[model samples]
Target: MAYFDQMGCKKRKRGERVFKFKTFGEQGHPVEFKGSFRQNVKSLLAFGNLGNSLCGGLASWSFQLEVHRNPPEHILLFVVEEPIEVSLNRHCKHCLHVGWGNHMICNKKYHFLVSSKETVATCFGYYEGNCNESYSGTAGKFNLVEFQGHVMHGVFHSNGFGHLLCINGVEMGSDLAGYQIMEFWDRLCTGLQARKVSLTDNSRKRSMDLRLLYGVAYSEPWFGRWGYKFGRGSFGVTQQMYRKAIQAIQNIPLCLLAQQFGNSSHDIPSMFSRYQTLSGHFLITLRDLLRFMLELKACLPSENGSIDTYHSGVLVDTTCRWSPKRVEMATRVIVEALKKAEFRWVSRQEVRDAARAYIGDTGLLDFVLKSLGNHVVGNYLVHRCLNPVTKVLEYCLEDISNGFFPSQEGSVTNDSELRTRYKITRAQLLKDMFCLYSHFLQEQKSMMNTGIFATTSLASRVILNSKYLIKEYCGKLPSLIQVGLGENSDVYCTIRVSHDGEVDEGRRKVIVPHECFMLRNNTTFNELMLEAEKSFKEIYFGLRNFSIKSIANLNAEGTDLVFKVVKVGGELVFEGSAGENGLNDEDVLEGFRRDSVVDCPCGAKYDDGERMVSCDVCEVWQHTWCVGIPDAAEIPSIYVCGRCEKDILEFPSLP
Candidate 1:
């Protein structure tokens, strides 16, 4: 207290960015809290009852932080605290070394946060998504962290950043919607020592995603105020960048006398970045970096636009007059074209060329196409990106199984487009994303239902209505580009995979253009196997996995030098790889739907690790449930499934 008071500590004013409070501590504890911010904290009342691990050693975890999610509309915002247990998945054991930590199954995931009342609840749903166990390995962590109950729940990486996966309840118009969210978010970020939260809006129209459907003070515009959403291929101010710059600049000695010059203000970005402050509580902003220390001023728009100070934020407010009804009326015009499209996915150009006959207004035509997100309405579903190599396509996620995906729904063909480097551009993709966002606005102004929505868009109203945050965000995300959508294209390369045995097989070289679209690194063992299937048919016989290595770096071992080369432009085609596959109950994943020979009465395969039994009469395998039995129930000495019993019983009855 004596230190801060003498050093110019003061109460935070109404609009100023700088503020200091009374009270101080040794700062040795993991999560030290001062009394002032206590009122804003949310308490996890049943933390003790939940009984989670304190310092971790119970099992293993990649990370140990809290997660917050926006549940679908039907889910209750506040419910009685439900019991949440965590566990690990044995099937996922192979990935433990790779950073896919303990999953939530057999009580392996519940590790409680201590005395911090901010941890009042512990109700994250069925399983953990991201790697929350040991930090060494990363599973490109994307986990389904369902909220069992409570406003905020779930365990995430303690040292990881906050990810706002979805935006819900905001349109419901509750003042507390944004308040509770911010409270939980702030607590999560503060505890994790994270600088900013990352949230992306990927709504492609059709399904009425909440990112759209709100106005002036709600929806995406609302989040705009607190955070800056950069444009295409943009990034935020990161500690990694600062550390890199500091490492580079530290070699140059500080020019102490240079600070005395009249031009010190311009040197602040350099000065603030160069020196590390003695105080541990404060966070430096981009604004602070540019005109921070020298001006002796506080942080201030960062504008929520770009990572740098020069660029401004972007806001999209489109006025669309389109709706489900309009598309229906123009059915003969649009549906006819969609039906005749060649590929499973239709491109925007294909759409324009097809609908040009009946659609008179160019803007209206464009809006109709853009608004048709990858979701199934009455006739068509908005299908997007396609993969030619894998023959797998992404349909409007809103309704992948809307009775129409690969199959036709009544009249409209299940259409998607191949986003090969030749067809789609980064600029076009970014433009279309915002264009679909505008679709929400265009919902035939009358259909916007703003009159009733006046009561909705809850969170945004709460955030702006009451200047809860002093440095309010400017209701705009100037940059709305998806990640990995850069100008960089795939290069033609040669990959030589050698078989282990010395007799028949030796090595086969796959000389193909490295793919740019696949989520995994350009080339992988499975990909090489698939590409060289004709050449290495015997090697890839049943479920044989291979070790892949780049011919260029064939000799590089597990030394740090190889890592350095890979970090730079150097490509390290590691032996082999994989990702966290979701727990699909029915066991059939359309994404991995290759040809299969499982003859179950129930038209499902991909087992997802469900129990299966052999039918004694026919010698065919069937899922326990499909043949009238429990998964854990004991099997009969001589079991006969319904399929086999049907014919035998019918034959006896006929005789």
Candidate 2:
């Protein structure tokens, strides 16, 4: 108190200082300091009724000097009579360890700060998807603490920073600074022994996923600027240019460039030579280098002529020297491109042709492409001189005015043509995939309505049943059916023939090959057998009479599933049961029929009566007046008893 007051500590108010100290004498007798107090004594209440640890060992004790001052003050002295004992429950004791301290499940640590003064207990535990654990073969140190039973109940964390500290299952002291937290802890354990409380690293408290940006391998300012605008803008020419640059290296379209530029250089074949020179290396023809230099000059549109034009510039270290300017950086990138080109040579004429192709495709000229041919000598000199370090790409452009890329080389190297072809191919493929995926999802949804769970494999059947996915096999079928010239041009039928037998008896399936389109379109059972003879000699030879009917289930044991294949109204369909293979329950196929224009039972060509009604039994349209029911509302829901009523009743009972 004296030290702080003498050293520029402002006097907030005037008050007397009181000290209450507890000490242990020689015989371990507790000695309390007698204090002069004329004020009333207030009794303190304990926190909770929870039992204390019976095996409680000596845990901790602390002594802190607290100061109090007020205006027109009266000095008062008060001391807590019953100190909070550091008690551990059975579970907490079991959770304690010697080196790493108390832990929860999976070797995770739980640190607790129990305050007797505030009557609050805070326990800090590790949460999943938090900080990555260090793998040093050692566990983290934590304090064994208890509130009611287990410390897992009142766990809470700040959503913003994931600052996890549980106070009775709620968060407390989260907004408090590290020093303030330490002071609060000290007040809570005044009688406890003093031990230094080490603060955990702030990185561990963060909820943000920052691992992707943990290193400093890239330059700060450039990376920051680029990262800020990484995926913000629209899909534009910049993306196309970047794509071209990548593709040039990946697809190696330089052969096309060599062919286009071959006429510009003498001994063009020699320019592409990979033969080692006299100095134990392949000699890069100076003329070939000149041709590439001219091509870059003709294609790239670098805005600046020299480094002197740059007001704000970066010092770029080339192999030969250090230079500063956006223009120089642009040249350095071109040099990198040439090195990657791997001795593939192109002529100046080829460069111009490539530029034309690029201008036609993108419909605009980039900075580098604009700069090319604008200042040929300047570009030539820069390309010849510029050589950069490996990490030159790490630098970012502070301003876009610095330069443009000679991306016209992309067109020259056949990159643009290839890209267009790829896009068309990709678009068609994408449309097909969308159709297939949509079909699968629709099938799944349909099956779900029928209380059937459609798995991934079953959903794929929708694609299999379609003609498009299996076009390679299905496309040739129509031609084979039309010609019937080839030996294998036949329709194959897999018929599962069932028989009356025991429950364990399986159905027998036979594959019968018939002549193409024989069982389709207006062909009767007798005609099918006669046509089947052309394909199957043994089964169909001289076969005459046969019976064909739609298969239906009537709890019969020996019912054979028959499918009548037909081309009804131009679509190949099976006129049979809805539950047939590859057909949905809703797909109940019907045969093609001709509707006869017959007069109604009322003896009219068309029903024109106002109160018209139709007989439900015979589907005969009749005037309500003729049926003795003049009102349309008087038409019974179960309309019957018309002229064909007796016949309708006996039709179902017919043998």
Candidate 3:
């Protein structure tokens, strides 16, 4: 993942904002203001909810700023210069009392309070005589004014259901932003519930990155990355459009499904519940996946196939009630029974495909998904996303909250009102986490690798793969799980699996058997390879235990499901045994859609490099083997295809 490529950690200036917004408007009509920051203060206030919201936090701190003469260059500047040391809760007249001050060696590490005023929260730090140097400014020089580190203020106190640790606000300097914020949330959040944890976040940042000074591959609004939400921010958004955005935000795609039929009720929380996998979502070469499979001596995966690892002696069948919780034991054995592997993504589809291939039952997969919020990635478009929701889960792997309360010692304001205020509800926290995930996806779309195949406006939902949690939550497996493409989904994909031979040097003596397989769902180039590998054995390309080559392309432009497809039980079934309760499946591929015309006029897509001959006349590349060239033939420097030869004969002056 090129996550860090566009990230910048340049220390922030003394009074700079966390981020800078491009415009206040949506897609077409950007709300650009020609007036000064002071002149537009009132206008900015009208955008978000007052007191505790997006730019409202800044506005509340600097409200009536247009009242003051020459209100400095920006809002934060005036906020820093003439501070308002008052808390958002007016009744708590003394919100900034010395609650408790414990001193440490270099800095005052552990001790602080919450302020609804984010600028005030930002000013909560005070390094005594032995502390390192802090930022400089007239107001900043006032040990009371300029505190650079992070300041997260909660409101949980003795009376009136106060100090519920509702996380009023947090202010962080640029130098210690992203990771530090993660640490803060980890300390405050309680824990998980049924392989699910909830947490909310709203990015108050608006970093002013001058394009003239630096070159970003791409950039978007702060919300477009972290709080990449659907509603409220857009201009003239009707309920219909909002609902549409909501529904599209769920299927993990932006399809125009009717509200009555769509997953309209699903939101970030829904996305969270459906998050399943825990492996690295990093994309690797198909050659790499094949290499990994070969190293493990793994057999090809089939939807109706039983789990069998011959080298590992792991045999898992799914018949007779999935054979009495036998899968539960096997699932543990492969993942945690022997050794709990590092948190890694586990593909739900991979497990389901093999289960369906083995037992010819979709119940197992349905049972697993039901436990994980029943999220379905509707179109091939969303399948391209890296499952942003899972990314949030991966980043915050540690148990942050203990159910409804914060994990940090001083986070709780009142144990009594914790349920009402501090309680991290599944609904709210899930919303925040989901927004963060959406933001992550948008950032990825703007990154260097994305094209129409990704970054499409239709993308909003990032469906998670949660096979890791299937057994944990899918208690008492159901008897006959029927799974298929959802309601009226007639779309089908045809994957053209041309052999990838780079991994097979002169060491192998075989031209990989030619074949094509229809893709079941949104798949990647690597998975196309995996299917080809299965076809190799499915067709008995070579003798058992003899290494065979098979890897190819989906023929479509491209789309990557950024999931770590965890292998089920590797090949334990032998020559003809399909294992207990397994179907003796023959190699068959169902195709859909006409193949798009690309590469050689012979209609073959690009093949292994050494086997392709570039036409010198038309300057178009062609598969040498497809153009009457021998498999063992070398490319001729001046070779021209038949079409080019005819064209040259018909018109001598043709360039």
Per-candidate TM vs. native?
0.23, 0.16, 0.19
Steric clashes per prediction? 47, 20, 44
State each model's CA lDDT, in order: 0.30, 0.25, 0.27
Off by over 4 Å in 3: 1-127, 130-140, 143-231, 234-242, 252-455, 458-655
Return the candidate ranking by lDDT, descending. 1, 3, 2
Q: Candidate 3 lDDT, tens digit per residue, 155-218?
A: 2111101111112222343322343333332322111001111122233222312110010111
Q: Estimate the lDDT of model 3.
A: 0.27
Indicate the residue-level lDDT of 533 in model 3: 42
**How do the residues 402-505 of candidate 1 rate in per-residue lDDT, one tens digit apiece?**
22112223443222331121132333333433442332122324454354222222222222222111111111111111223343222222233333322112
Candidate 2 lDDT over 1-655, as tens digits, reads 2222332123213342322211211111121111101000110111111211211221222122233243121111112121112222211111111111111111012132323222222211221122254422112232224333221111101000011132221223232333333333332222111111111111211221111111111111111221211111011113233233222222323243344335654333322321110011111332222223223233333433211111111222364232334443443343334334443433333333444542332212233323332122111211211125432111111111112212223211224443332222223323422332242222346534332224322322322211100001111122213322333122332122222211112211111211133233334544433333322222221111212222222221222211233222122211121122322111111110123122344344332213455666556555565567755457878676455777766676656
RMSD of 2: 34.6
Q: For residue 614, what is the lDDT in candidate 1?
A: 71
lDDT of 1 at 23: 10
